[model samples]
Target: MSPAHAGRPGQAIQIGRDYYEGPLHICDSVTSLLAHYLDLLDRGAYEVGEGDDYIGFVADPYESGFDPELLSGGIPHDVPSGLQAVLIQVNAPRSPLDLTPLAAAHLRRLDLKRRPVTDLTPIRDLPIESLAVSLHDGDLAPLEGHRHLSSLDLATNTTIDLTPLRTAPNLHGLDLSQATVQDLTVLADFPHLRYLALTASQWASLLDENKVPPALAAARLSKRDASRTEALSWAARLGLTVGASFVISGTLTSDSETGRTQ
Candidate 1:
């Protein structure tokens, strides 16, 4: 709604009667929306911190930049079409601000049990680190500019053939929990990888404790009722900030806050 189109005091502005409506008057192109949106954000129109509740709001990327896939139950599955993005907060609030839109598929929380590693493929020209494009049961096909990705969160996504990761030089963090991942040698491709969280991952067994010599960013690895000393020791050796946590006999625990390794 524009100011010039304001009808007589308190009068409703009907689309048909309100006047000729088109780009001639006001066009909501990506640029326009982005300008207003950023202004709103700069002035604090919305919260600055987000956690998990925000999903399906803006399910796609801005019309301008390269957008990634918004997967749902499986590979062929996707979120509602017209959706763009959403606003919410993660369960663990890092700051009072809630500014996470989860763009490019940075999915943090939700019910994904139904979404299994699938019979589908990843989109082309996408994969921002913040996005969560986890392939539940399939492999993410390589993109044109594969190494440009910043982060790829495929936690618990099994059946993932991360050949694409070889090209993802920009990749920094990865969450492959309970998924089918075999080697970190592929990760050697990502020299800048800092934060890594692999808890009870399918490849946990395959991971040669020696391979994960830290020197990266913060690391969080946990498994079924595990004694995190082993993982922590490896993390320390690599110079990574380690925060090991996991579930044990229905109880949740972390090595940092708790002294016992239950």
Candidate 2:
């Protein structure tokens, strides 16, 4: 298909089984795009088009007996030309995996959640805007120079130093939930940061009015303790006047400022 006939070549496109006739269009979210691709893979109808841009594949070891090698080979060679985002989710073998096929200089986003990948030296120079990875004692020095990065998810990484993030001036959203970071002072470097997530216990440490970034707008606290009164109290002090939501036994219940479960 001609570049003009196909929607904007830069628009995000999710690879799926559906026989789409024209250029791909943007999807509502990356999660939905991944679901469409997984459905296509199940139906054995997924095909990579020449004009395709963003694409993702998820392999569930328990359900589909996912083979990392097979998934790697399935990626088309043309994907490197204009591909923007490449999300790969794999299970088992907690070791770094080389994703040479998906490595493109123009790539803008990458999500390797729950994957065995540890080393990120390969794509360190790419102008990526968003990145999510699960690293276990892996070197994070590669991320030090990623100034274009805006959204980062290091939730699965336990041991990490926030010092490297000082260079990422464009960072806006960050996820450090379940991480082993002890210092909240490092966040003062991110002048543009607005959204943050961390363990409930870390809320107290970040409550220091002088330490919290002025632009911080919202926060998601996971692993919440039985009583969130202290957390909410801290939030109130930080000028986060918004209400809170509580997840109990997988059921989310909106809570008012009075601590009443709505």
TM-score each candidate: 0.43, 0.61
Clashes of each: 33, 0
Model 2 residue 145 lDDT score: 60
What residue pairs are clashing in model 2?
none
Residue 34 CA displacement from its true place in model 1, Å: 14
- Candidate 1 vs. true structure, TM-score: 0.43
lDDT of 2 by residue, 116-200 (tens): 5567777777777778877766756888968678888885355567887878778898888756774777887787889988766
**Lowest summed lDDT window (length 10), candidate 1:** 92-101
Give one digit per residue, the lDDT tens place, for model 1 in 167-199. 666567667664566564565455667877676
Alpha-carbon RMSD, each predicted model: 16.2, 10.9
Locate the minimum summed-lDDT window of 10 residues in model 2: 60-69
